[model samples]
Target: MATTEQGNGLAPRGTKEKLTGDRKRSDPEMNGGVPGEKPVDKYGFTGGAQQHCGESAEEIPIEVLRQREAKWLEMLNSWDKWMAKKHKKMKERCQKGVPPSLRGRAWLYLTGGKVRREQNQGKFQELDNQPGDPKWVDIIERDLHRQFPFHEMFAARGGHGQQDLLRVLKAYTLHRPEEGYCQAQAPIAAVLLMHMPAEDAFWVLVQICEKYLPGYYSAGLEAIQLDGEILYALLRRVSPVAHRHLKKHKLEPILYMTEWFMCAFSRTLPWASVLRVWDMFLCEGVKIIFRVGLVLLKSMLGSQEKLKACQGLYETMELLRAIRPQYMEEAFLVEEIIELMVSEKDIEKEHHAQLRHWKETHGDLHCKSPPRVHGAKAIMAAEPPSRQDLRQRPTFIVESPLAPQTDRVRAEASKENGKSKAEQQKTIKPPQETANPYFPPGDPSPFLNHMTVKASKESLSSAEHDTYL
Candidate 1:
């Protein structure tokens, strides 16, 4: 609810901005900008990129970025150790915000998406290659263009961005046929596609749907309705002012929070705030979503002057739809969200109370699935059922380049060509240790057998562990 302004890593308006070489470009396609554009923002998304609301991000020194990246890289390389022993430090770093370039990989790790992909090798390719169910296919295709129509990736109808998006969505329906496809999933998938490849996006979406926010996208959407009720109850404790205002109007949380909570606020918040919120959400879990909603409501309805302007449902709804620019600022919003005292245990307590009420009134709760542990951390700790049938394929790209799948195929071909096993063995030689994918190519980094690079899925399993990390 605090409206105090602070520098959001960008300099104040009218201040002399820092100069870094001609990072400028005139290409209109430079992030879907207008033709003849010649300016570029340091964030790589403004001006020609035009990715945001035309505001230039503050110039962060390159040195500072490098140091942060290194720290994150170290944490990523040894994530299991840190998660087991140094979790506090890891959580603190994630709160500050992940480096932009590393956001995709960080998400794959934090959401345990990479591990899921590893667990069910080639599942994405299988689902994507198969023709999806007609019911979900039509719905997914119709909804794809509606997601991020302004962003360059999805700006083109049926472009690769949309194509990739279709693959992910269709794959999800095939992956979990009972749940099928939901319209809100398109925007959430679009956000993931903005960062990762189609395959990675698919797995992350799975983690989001099945792990982080269970039953939200199911046929009845009972889980989201339950969550909406939970949010309303928590608002009573979070900001009684906001709660009282809603109570006075008989306003329902479902009216405002449906899109916000379902899409992870992607369709609602400004670009910067959305990304910052996502960084925390991937690491901490769905509690961050509740915290964000509580903050936005408190900021909008916290004070008498604000409440006076929103005396009716229409006015309050409009106020939420068009939130003040200051409340949505990245620096301001994230700080307030982190400062809030909401916890997963409290949300769970409310969830149980809400479920009990639902059963007492409506009977059965009509759940298609059972209850779940809802968080990225909890997902990692739980033991998912093994799929012995799906492990036939080799590990994802993390295989050693020296012995790629291509190499294995070639060796098999040689044997078919009447070559002796001894000859094939001599030509192949023993495979050296897996090349580390965590570091730059040819960077001479030591092999962390436990480490994994999602891009190559690079992993050297000298030792066995739950995940590559």
Candidate 2:
């Protein structure tokens, strides 16, 4: 399979021959006769004196072929190692932050998502499966449409958002039944679909819920609760004042913060920040999340000074999503903010140690669970709360125990007549004093449980709240 150009270049290495359009190889010196030299043909491949293929051409030398083969083998060997090194470097670069143009492809590579695969091709082509359970297809279909209602483009591309979402969710429901499709998967899948094809989106979703953000989307949401509890601890350590403010105001982290743990900063932050977080998230593992939560809480401390200027959980989560410090800078900025706001938030250091421990132990157990077959179903029975587990519930250092002691139902009845001042009065109450104090004051209280909060100007109003539910 030697090409003509390579053959020409390899032959007659010592002689200078310029090739003409017809693949003729000629040497000018061969044409000219020197004083003692025998006259030769102009072409480098001369058979007889002064003849260029006049009758029979001379046989090519075996040594020439051997030399050419040696050179080719050498080049192949070098190229193989070069490609290997290149691939390794590219993997490193992807984990840092995929360059803009290569992001889509690199994301596929980094997360092990195959855009076109034989097994999944038919699945992608087929229409979503209709199942008997109001359990599986019904729930998947509902979220498929609901995932990105805010995006007009998604709405327009019925195939892109609604259809793809349904396909992936349904297929996954069939693919991994133990941990059936969950609520957070919709938004996470929506974000991936924005940057990737549907198939890649499906696998990326797999890596996320199953590998990356484990336990959170599981049967009990125990992992999600654990992460939030960890976040609260970090916030308290790094931004004690903000933690105090949020609690003094009777704010529960999950009510506002669940989106952060669920989507990993997707809806809360700017797109760029979300990607940066994802970069570290996938590389550094789940521990990066706690550090990030600490970093975000610290950032908000600076904004807390203005009267009634406090932010809700969603806005706070969004701010974390908005800021995208470079890899080198994120560590310092996180530390600086934590130090600035907390004076004592050692959560990052503790997390760093925990990460070291995690690395030393069996690799992230979160991602290595046995795959199950419960599409859109809980993976396992809920773990019952035991005495040992109950004893470990987080205790506030200066504050009362974690979990509020009273339900807001009694407070709501008392405030029905005094709806206007109920929230302000609630904030002033000694019992509620044990709760967070900067709580917003308004009618139709936003706080629904004992962990009640007042509606902020930016939060959902009564009409909007009704619509949202």
Candidate 3:
């Protein structure tokens, strides 16, 4: 319940006030007036892309902005060297905040999304040409305007921004057919679209879904539920009083945290803070999310005001939903979040413990069948076994049928073309066993080689970890 106001370490008090005043003076009307529409006195609620209200108002010297942009461009041009030799410096820059002018490209670089975009050139258009799943299409259309309703880019229903948003979400549905159109993903995809082109946004979304947060938006939401448990465990350590109060009110983490984590704080945090969180999140991992949740809980309920105002679950939920704008200011909030001492090792330890608890209480959590890829043969030799099979065979080895078939076809083709079978066989080796589809490549967990009841086994590899699940 410490109530002392701490200044954002990023700027001095006078500088913070100057920045605020500059934004207020540079109202949206001064900056092209929302494209074919009159600017309102205020742009609805103060969150999402409109967090700065009048971002164009700040009159930083063009030369200064160029200097910042140049620094970013140089880092991006030599990203491999920077990542290998100056990762700590890169993280420090991200923590300070990626300049808004260069944020899109910086984000693409940080996520390695530019590489994905290159590999999947023309793929988004291909997916767009095919009619999307009607069910997912309907949901995506309904939710399109619900995201950043006041931002100029998506203000009009069929505007370029909205259309781009539709393509990105639709392409994702086609890309990961199994986890089609989770409601939470729409805002995430929308945020990415705001920064980059539709195709690049699609690839960024792919990295987030497949690499950052695998299994989170899946049908069962098993990852989200497990993380809820993990969040509660961290709360007990970081803010015991808040934890006790929540327990007394029978408040479950899911009731409040589902949207927060699932959407990667796109809804809960102010736009600037959201961007800052994303910057750190791309460089670091899920630990930033856990630290943020703990900070939010402590700030909301750890004061005398809360003892009177948040007396029940309903009031507490409202407090979280309607957190004051000042508290969410990126400079202060992100500074506080990073200052917290939580580490990846701590999060991993808690994850293993939570997984064990979940298994002991709920038995084996069944995984749904892997979603089928359109117009392609099954990637694996066999479907993942049922719950009974999982219990019987914990190793869950997956052999690639496509590889062996391709090798045989190559051998026959070579023989017909006058080359000997021995030459073909020498060139083409037999397919080897690979990890299960559920366990994607580049997973960093030690237990990935085996599929067992150990809580850690259920989690995705460290490289793919996301706060949503």
Candidate 4:
């Protein structure tokens, strides 16, 4: 798959392009020279040849993989049965890693994407058919090429990868106009496109933004800005040394971690580690992201000698921006995260405390902003994406904690009295945590139970808003 032209050089006029089009400055000489030969990275990505880890996943014996995939297929076939009887086993397997062959199907099941898709048939196609908002469309088009240029799927401009990526982003804006389109979504959609088709990818992205990480891509990014506080709080307990260094340097979590969490670390970790982190993230929740960030911090600044290198905010920021090779190694990083003691309960507790602090400092978020939609399908259930359309679709109800439907109802009921309703609307509480089909009890994923937040104007900072990776 080696393109003739590479290294920012122009191709000879007669040298035909092997890729979908002529190579851009970002495109490089693909690792494998022979046509159709496997790229040095089994994932079909280039430019990571220098960063190859100690143990290659490709080295896993084919027989072992086939057996693993078989086991996964069996569990998938009887998913609910497995969840009821042996949920712990499934959760552990996810931590180890979903087989690459079954990653897409696994992700669909893990994120409840399959159920979501089934409930709302042809919804993606319908939204994709309609023209997207002009504001989002122009921005989406500009950011498409910046995602995973080293990966074959998005290597070419206007190629199916880029095309599919565009559809997914545009559809989300249409699906949840309140959230609009956030720049952090580009790399995330690109990663999803690599594994699943556009339709499935779109739904997974929905689950990620809405369910897994609520209010992340929403207007003021209140969810993530708040999580930044939560992460630092947990860091104090998990790694006191690292936390002290960050506090001394005044290196706010938002300064470096914004892009990391906003995109679910798709832009932060090595591709292999990114997939593994996602596998767990899908099963557990945002706590997986918190744990990963904590592990990186502990590794970078756990020791006095490590702190010696980071004297000021700039040095500490640089160290975080470019993580060392040892930390980036997939197996090592996942192992460290697993070994780390931080749990969903810990994250949940910190989130609740931070919520109280934010309200005191920022005032009532809802007071300033218009009536904002808390989550997607809750409203969609009450009203379809396009209720007035002639076509009919099933009522896609989401029993998600992120969507406070009952609160919305009570708010509406109070609307008959204007002044009283305004007082009542000071806060719209998030719903309580329900038993997740993906992670049953004893496993513990701390989402939906508390920490109500108000969304708003200072949405994403310039760095966060402009983050293309």
Candidate 5:
């Protein structure tokens, strides 16, 4: 019997003939692979494609993907109309998430990145061609690979991703020489590039630094510190247990929260959560950051398991750094953050209060004073806000049968007390040192002092009335 060659070019039977024909090629890689092209996995997606933490590309269904793409295109076509009239619907969709295929375009629309790109045409190239501030250039180069090292786009040294990141950073240094560049900006820029092209990414970064979070990346980082104080106040009200634990352990918000706020949680959170946060941050403003921070703190320290696991300051810090993936489930996390009820109004009110306190202590100082470091002290021993201050602002209403005394009654009581105005003022001490180490040291203004006194009197009266009841 004659020997024959197999289809794959192997000789058949017991024949010792050397098979000499070009080996049959394997099936072309899926997703339109070309011969000799970069190797791709079984799925058609390329190596450069981003893989969200805890999620695989292959798991997504093709039909669902098509629908997402279609929905995105429809939204893009009518973006102006959607923004003007269907903003609620648009916000709802964004909250759900911008589909991966359309995320870049959606972000562009959300941030008005396209308009900024058009306005600054050729500007990035011009800046890139110039020698950036040598200091920032070196820093930007160092950070390029540090960002998204696992992702193919940024994994390679001096690759297109890095080059784009460098150009964007260098352009920013030139764009705002005073601010120069900050390390936190690298991740923010890198995340933007992952979703959009470099120019568009740069513009989006411009919107973020300039519009969304003004004064955030500047030399002083005053806004960030101020926001940290604001977050502390919110946390105290939202989750007192967690707040007390952090204070007891001396885990100042600055120790952990600086990077969280500075990078907009890009470095702290899982990629999926980060993208979802960015979606809301783009839509809702910086308030989302505060809300997210509160949720993470409450989830991490609110429970016994997490608290026990984090016994010391170092352990607590580590726990915060390696946030459990379970807490980062985007839908659940976003919903929890939304339910936090930390409105911008609340944040603004706290900001003004903090600012007033800051000014009273350090008279029109441009630079923020360093936060005081306190040793172990009774958590309750921290000075409370003056009673008079509380009376002036009845935002926190205590339900009691005793109605607030009338102005006439208050005046008569003051007269009967026979205390001079100065003596009466002396009765109300200044706002005491805050238990929160993050709170800047300050004395309450005279007006705040008066409010504190009134608040104390009202509280005492309410207590006596309750006892009578």
Candidate 6:
């Protein structure tokens, strides 16, 4: 939304021009013409890494890292004390309102569950060093880089956030190998590291995944599924029109709210609103997530009209991401949501009867089958291509009970072809070849596979690549 000019170097376009005076100079370095020299225009500023005027590179202070660590440690310890006071004051302030800066820390403090007065200064190391089987460590290692692979905000910003996430995730995998590493946890961890220290983020996540949220990252995925069922039921009760439309279309509420509920609205809502929701979440429990889900459906009541004109679940998610309470009457809208969706009876019920009924009727909602590892497995299970089926084409890999049969057929063909070629070339010397036959003619040799080829290295022209295996 804000344009920064090239002058400021950090800002986009017109924004920088307004904020900073216009100064121009011609320099080839700015255009990446120079190989090793620091990029400079007439002002002697580099286009990439920043350097102050006439300042030399210098060593960073050892105390700085210590200070950073110490600060979080102190905050972690004081969290309980803060929350004890915070719990007493929260209800009154919610009726009033939390100050902005105070809100983020308050949310962090409560969510951290930093209750015990005793210091956990050395306990983090003790927890980290606890002996465990090395298998999860291997899994964590594989996913470490792939975790936050995208996101320009995470890219080249600083190693601090990434390093923090890696340490916490690795420690957690070591701590609870049962959950191991799930795809969704990395993005959640990245979001936490944006606001708090790595250790605090780590512990907070552990609490949420274990105590607060129901088996979210567990093998069964029971808790997240339960939450989805509850959300759907609440929506059905609160907004029957939306529910009927969604049911007719076979759309699941979890498709939109999965990220929302799992991350405590961390990824979907603005940081400020997330903080407010979290303030209540920690003081209360996971009830707030359900309440918010009801709110989202109710808010979109206008949009969900006229034969499901509402864009699918993904479009609903985009709408949530783009707008916030500030645009509307924040207090009244929040109150309306709470009044319509949340009930003491629903929140108080340990496990709702409606949820049980939904699960029983729609067993597929709870399904968290392990992903097919081999492409071949997927191909064999492919549905017969119908009007609906053809719209979603099957994978290229061969998947079938007859896959072994297909392999045997290929092997027989290879043998027959090899024998014919050998007999035909018998007049000359037969080429010394084997009948392995995985690779076809003109395939690059193993050694040449490492060599760079522009054609091969370039991304596929189409949306996807066909896999033979």
- Candidate number achieving the greatest TM-score relative to the actual structure: 1
| Per-residue lDDT of candidate 3, residues 232-322 (tens digit) | 8888888788888888888777666766776788767866678789888766766777778888888887666565888887888678766
Candidate 4: clashing pairs of residues: 220-459
Put down candidate 4 lDDT per residue, 1-469, tens digits, no spaces. Answer: 1112222121222222221123334234332122233354556575443324457743667667667766876676566556557777887888888877567767776676666787787899999999999988887776676666666566666777788899999999999887777777777887777776688789889877767777766655567667888999998998999999988888777776776787777767777788899888887667778889989989999889999988998888778877897787788988987888887678777877987898898865442222222222222333342212212121222234454557655575567455565666665455333332223464322211221222211111111111111
lDDT tens digits by residue: candidate 6, 11-103: 221121211113232343222232244544221223322222333122225455344333433333343343345444444443233332233
**For candidate 1, lDDT tens digit of each residue in 1-469?**
1111121111121223211112333344333333343332322232321246454353357677667766877776666666668877877878888776567777877887777887777788888889989877876676665555556566566677789989999998888877777766778898887776677788889888877888887765678778888999999998899999998988777767777887898867777778889989988889999999999999999888889898898899778877887888888898999999999899999999998997887787565655555555566567542333112232223444454456565686666678777776778645453443322565432223223444333333321111111
The candidate scoring highest on lDDT is 1
- 35-110, model 5: which lDDT tens digit per residue? 3545433212233323352344225476675666566556655555555577777777777776665566567656
Give the per-residue Cα lDDT of candidate 6 at 146: 34
- Measured with C-alpha atoms, the lDDT of residue 286 in candidate 3 is 64
Number of the candidate with higher lDDT, 3 or 4:
4
| Residue 171, candidate 5: C-alpha displacement in angstroms | 0.2
Q: What is the TM-score of each candidate against the true structure?
A: 0.74, 0.46, 0.67, 0.71, 0.65, 0.51
lDDT of 5 at 137: 85
Instruction: Evaluate model 3: give its TM-score.
Output: 0.67
lDDT score, residue 291, model 1? 92
Ranking by TM-score: 1, 4, 3, 5, 6, 2
lDDT of each structure? Answer: 0.69, 0.44, 0.61, 0.66, 0.62, 0.45
**What lDDT is reached at residue 58 by model 5?**
29
TM-score of 2: 0.46
